[model samples]
Target: MDKVQILRKISQIFFFIYFIFFTSFCLCFFGLIEKFILKGSFGSLVLKLVVIIVLTLLFGRVFCGWMCPFGFLMELSYKLRAKIYKLKKLPKVSEELHNKLIYFKYLVMILSLVLTYYLATYAFCKVCPIGFLTNLYGTVISLIILITFLIASFFLPMTFCRYFCPLGAFLSIFSIRPLFILKTNNNCVKCRLCEFKCPMQIKITENVNQKECIRCFECKSSCKKGGISFSIK
Candidate 1:
């Protein structure tokens, strides 16, 4: 209801438009045109990859929070699951379990890198269900991708990003540095509102690294005590 929350909501909306609608649309259209009309060129593919990597470095995992089709799908699915199953009322996983699972993203990233190195392509992107959905053009493969997306959504909360999203994993390393992080002051009341607002289910108070944090500013907006602020160090 406050200005901060309003701004956060607006920012999220902008992210949805940029990442899901605009970027995905461009990538899908470009890929199709290159493969069919222009004939796939190695140069074009490499250029696209370079652009994505540069964006990641410049913005951290802002792409994950803002532009990733899978992230958007997960958020939408979370809302639906909350409505259908009343899951919003349920307590998040225990802190012990949550922290442990946080490492899963990094593990997935390493595995994905290995696979890409061996396969000479981003294997995860090649088979990403969300990416496939965004590019769906009537293919049996898309059907399989759809099924996978449904199953993941029904079972786990942001399961793809938590356990399988190699890009999320890739970003974790960059996020650990003392830069572009939400900092808290001593006035902190430990209200724990930030923890709840974090969609990644991170224990924001204890571990700031929180690989799952997308820098969405949800926690900063949620802090009623005005204890949280941004820092780049």
Candidate 2:
């Protein structure tokens, strides 16, 4: 890995440790919003959410790339799958199918919020993988859901982030046109290495500012020709 990717990995590790041991609340945006809606109150949690939204507006989904503990676990699962299977290249969903599947996360976001509001309960949290990871839930359903998503991640890196995470869907609203974005320069040979390396499976050459981009900088680091760079949009 290049220096950028190495630094990103270290950041991910540091934040994952901090999240597990230092933080008390589940940082999942969906969960936080649900609680705020249910309680109809504002406090430190809402403040944190506001800060996250502002940061996302400026920097894209850096939390996913460098901070989210569950995202880190999913990435690990992807690497483990590659190692165990001795895969030369990770499998990728077709672009057409990928485009269609991305909408599912938005659907999840809407359904989860609406359901939580109408049902007067945090319905989605019962099955949220992050809740399971953070020991917020200990039921059989949570365990099953966590295992299912972990297996999906093993087969398709970032399957949850790409097509199922409500938090990602929520954050995408701000990240879609963040101030900073990945861009390609004249040096690009269209080798498509960056797209292959992107865990979110973003079509970097076509739309580097894609909402699904997690600001991981994998695309930048993977470009041996120095074709890709993160810069003001």
Candidate 3:
């Protein structure tokens, strides 16, 4: 791995540990939103949400790339699967299918919000895979949900983040036009290495400012030709 990828791995590990120690305060953004709706007021958790929104607006979804504990697990699972299969690179969904599937996250986000508001409960949290990780006492159904998603990640890589994570969907709203974005330069050979490396499977060459981009810089680091860079957009 390149320096940027190494740094990102270190950041993911550190934040995963931090998350374990502060699970209550570091609940996923969707869970926090559920809490705010159920209580009908803002709290410290909401303050954290505000901070996340600001950061996402400026830097894209850095939290997913660098901080999310569950995302870290998904990455690990993907790596493990590759190792077990002795594959140079895992297969990716077709671009047409990927485009269709990505919108599922947005639907999940809207459904979560609507359910939380109408049901007067933390409906999403009750089954959230991240919540399941933090709260081991969750129901058997939650355990099934967690295992299912983890297995999906092993096969598809970040399946939850790309297609089902309400938090990712919510963050995408602010990250679509973040201050900084990944861009390709004149040196690009269209090798498509960056796309293969992208955990979120973003088509960086086609659109660097895509909302699904996690700002991981994998594309930048993977480009041996120095074709990709993160810059002010």
**Candidate 3 clashes between residue pairs 3 or more apart in a chain or in different chains:** none
What RMSD, rounded to one decimal, does every model reach? 5.3, 1.7, 1.7
- Per-residue CA lDDT of model 3 for 155-229, tens digit only, reads 998999999988899999988888887789999999988887787877777876558888778778778899987
Model 1 CA lDDT for position 7 = 63
Q: How many backbone clashes does candidate 3 have?
A: 0
Q: Across residues 1-233, which tens digit of lDDT does each residue of candidate 2 receive?
A: 87777899999888777766654755666777888779987556777788889989888998888888778888999989888988756679887998899999999999989998999888788777766556675467877877888899999998888899888888999888888877888889998988877888877777674588888786787788999877887
Task: Give the worst 10-residue stretch by lDDT in candidate 1.
Answer: 28-37
TM-score of each: 0.70, 0.93, 0.93
Residue-by-residue lDDT tens digits, candidate 1, 7-80: 64566666556544543344332232224323335444556545655654554566567556556666677657
The TM-score obtained by model 1 is: 0.70
Shift in Å, residue 185, candidate 1: 1.4
List the pairs of residues colliding in candidate 2: none
